[model samples]
Target: MRRYGPAVLLLLTGAAILRISLLSELYLRYVQAGLRPYLVVSGFLLVLLGVAAAVAGRREQEPHGAHGGHHAPRIAWLLALPALALLLFPPPALGSYSAGREAAQRAAQGVGAFPALPAGGPVALTLAEFSSRAIYDSGRSLTGRTVRLTGFVTRDDDGTWYVTRLLVSCCAADATTNKVEIRGADAPPADAWVTVTGTWHPKGSLGTDGAWPPVLDAASVRRVAQPANPYERR
Candidate 1:
């Protein structure tokens, strides 16, 4: 246990970071409301416990026959599996996998308005940034101009693919799903991260039954890999 103790502690620390960063959004969406607080508290405890275990293990190594064996702690390495899982299979982005989920309950309210752009320059914004700004300003400022955006793939009704970005407040637990319509030659694979340069055009008068209005008419689509920092905004 002593030999692997530091490795176990590192794994726990990495898991804690992932839990706070990427996976929080999934937990917020799928987990029951009542259990959220407990999950958070437990995550905090895990971090503390990992730190304590590491420290204790180091102290124990100083004393001979602490574990009544000649070998160092072997069991400590077993703790690394969960952290490895998190690194390998991160929670899915808030896309079609989560479309059927309740939007109002899951989406963040009032993300605040985007800053006004200077006259005559291409507008660059993430799906979340555009959505928050559009909500506040009614898309008045975004009309009739080329825009640059990036995100993974999501599809809308009528078989149109969107370049979507997830706005996460915490892990996958509290993620806001937003997407922009991608229009151009060559459809990219679902969930492939891409940078799109396009024109932002209104799809005309919010679709029936209050659907999201307007989509970007993509001028260019360049496929890219999942970024090191996957979330769109902080």
Candidate 2:
């Protein structure tokens, strides 16, 4: 335990940093709708565990000289579980679950701004990427071409399903949900991962003031599952 203390502490610290980073302002706005409470709880737990690990490291008994005692290497292996879990079953992406909640919030405030996409190429973007670009271009840049996207299903509403990709600045707590509307695909189970191939059509009438009115007319949709690391980097 003593020999592995530093590594454990480092892991905990790294996790904490990740969580805090995801909870930043831009990301937090969307994450708050569905995950704020859970994140708060998780944050508290992480803090407590971090403190416990620090205290334990300080209280541990010192090892004797090499001739007297050799530290056991087995304790270092204990960290494998968490490392494996993160590698294998990373938490699901923010999908349909956050759609309605976020949409409602955005509606109340009016749709936010978006940027224009550059000319001459199919934009390969995540929901977050498109959203950020939309802020600057308002869908003007993506008017007539296909945009490829991938994300998890968050939830479904009346006749409309919302797909989302999580953009995390640090960790889940700071993660933000970027949403896209699927107009005519078979609805997959909520939280299922998927890739969407479609064209962006400006929703001329449905857009909020200063926001681009556009929806993805999905040509094909395929379901998958969350990846090892679920967050999109800034």
Q: Say which candidate scores most in lDDT.
A: 1
Native-to-model Cα distance after best TM-score fit, residue 202 in candidate 1, in Å? 1.1
Off by over 4 Å in 2: 1-122, 135-139, 204-214
Residue 201, model 1, lDDT: 64
lDDT of 1 by residue, 1-234 (tens): 455466476646556544744465444433433456666667666677767767666766476556574443455565666666654554544555553352532234543335566677567776766654454444366767677887787664567887776666555556666776666646677767788888766554431213353467777888887665566544
Candidate 2: tens digits of C-alpha lDDT, residues 28-129:
423433455665566556656767777777777766665433344455555656644543444434555544454321222333445555565556786756
Where model 1 places Cα greater than 4 Å from the true spot, the runs are 1-80, 84-115, 133-139, 156-158, 204-213
lDDT of each: 0.60, 0.58
Indicate which candidate wins on TM-score: 1
Error of 2 at 82 (Å): 11
